[model samples]
Target: MKSELQVFQDYIRGRELRRTPERERILQEVFEIHGHFDVDGLYLQLRQKGVKVSKASIYRALPLFIDCGLVREVDFSEGHWHYEHIYGHSHHNHLRCLGCGDIREFENPALDHLEEQLAREYGYHIKGHHLQVEGYCPGCRQAGAFPAESNFLAKDSNDQ
Candidate 1:
């Protein structure tokens, strides 16, 4: 696997931008996390490492990374967008907890079959699909984490 730095370097090269130490540093930090991070979070991490970079620089560089197909943008309903390294991986859907903000990745053959069947029935060719399920997680439910009439919530409400 190409290091994230190498990926970023290639991106800069393809864009005809001269490679700089600051760009390398930023890419290194982003690659190390390899998870969701917003612009402010990335800036804070770089600052913690004594890297003096402006927020605007990181923001501008992110789109370049995206354009280069080295990163992906994810919206987790947290009122902020996050980015992750794509690394030439196949697509997968996300399951998220609306209350706890926990995210899980899953692949379902049944869902795939359903999409294919629907496409065939409609006389259309399937190209791609994105499915996201968001709800309270089991732990959240057990803890009465959401405002609903779940069994745990009912028990607690009855006790009260």
Candidate 2:
């Protein structure tokens, strides 16, 4: 029942790394994000928030935070990894909007049960899994959002 920061301190202690204000600041900045975020996006966010934290520091702390179970890395098939802080929260899945890059979180006990059943039938131990469904969100569809083509293509069509 230790706090997330306490758990992180324990993790760093086991690794023989000294606790620093930089790691603590990075952890605080990360906890401020309520949704999925990428490394660069997080770095930029911290900078914009006047946190005085360096990108290298954030990048270095992310793996440790993940190992400490404070952040969970998620993949939405966008060629990069997104992370969510899962400490003090239950696990969930994602629904990503292909048109606008919006992401929604969801959870279902049925899906969890199905995963367990499938793993049991295959005689494999389930460590963890990630599910990301992609489609146009309601807002995108309402706005007629579509993936933009190349600038050349747009120019050619406009010249017609």
TM-scores, each model vs. reference: 0.75, 0.81
Error of 1 at 105 (Å): 2.2
Between which residue pairs do clashes occur in model 2? Answer: none
Error of 2 at 87 (Å): 1.2
For each candidate, what is the lDDT?
0.81, 0.85
lDDT of 1 by residue, 42-158 (tens): 999999989999998898788878877777788887788888776766667889997788888888888889988999899988876767798778899889889755676445543
Task: Report the C-alpha displacement of residue 22, candidate 1, in angstroms.
Answer: 1.6
Candidate 1 least-lDDT 10 residues: 149-158
Candidate 2 lDDT tens digits, 1-160: 8778898999999999989988998888888888888989988887888878777888789999999899988888789888889999988888889888888889989888988998989998887778888777878867978665567744434368
State the displacement of the C-alpha of residue 95, model 2, in Å, after optimal TM-score superposition.
0.4
Model 1 RMSD, rounded to 1 decimal: 5.1
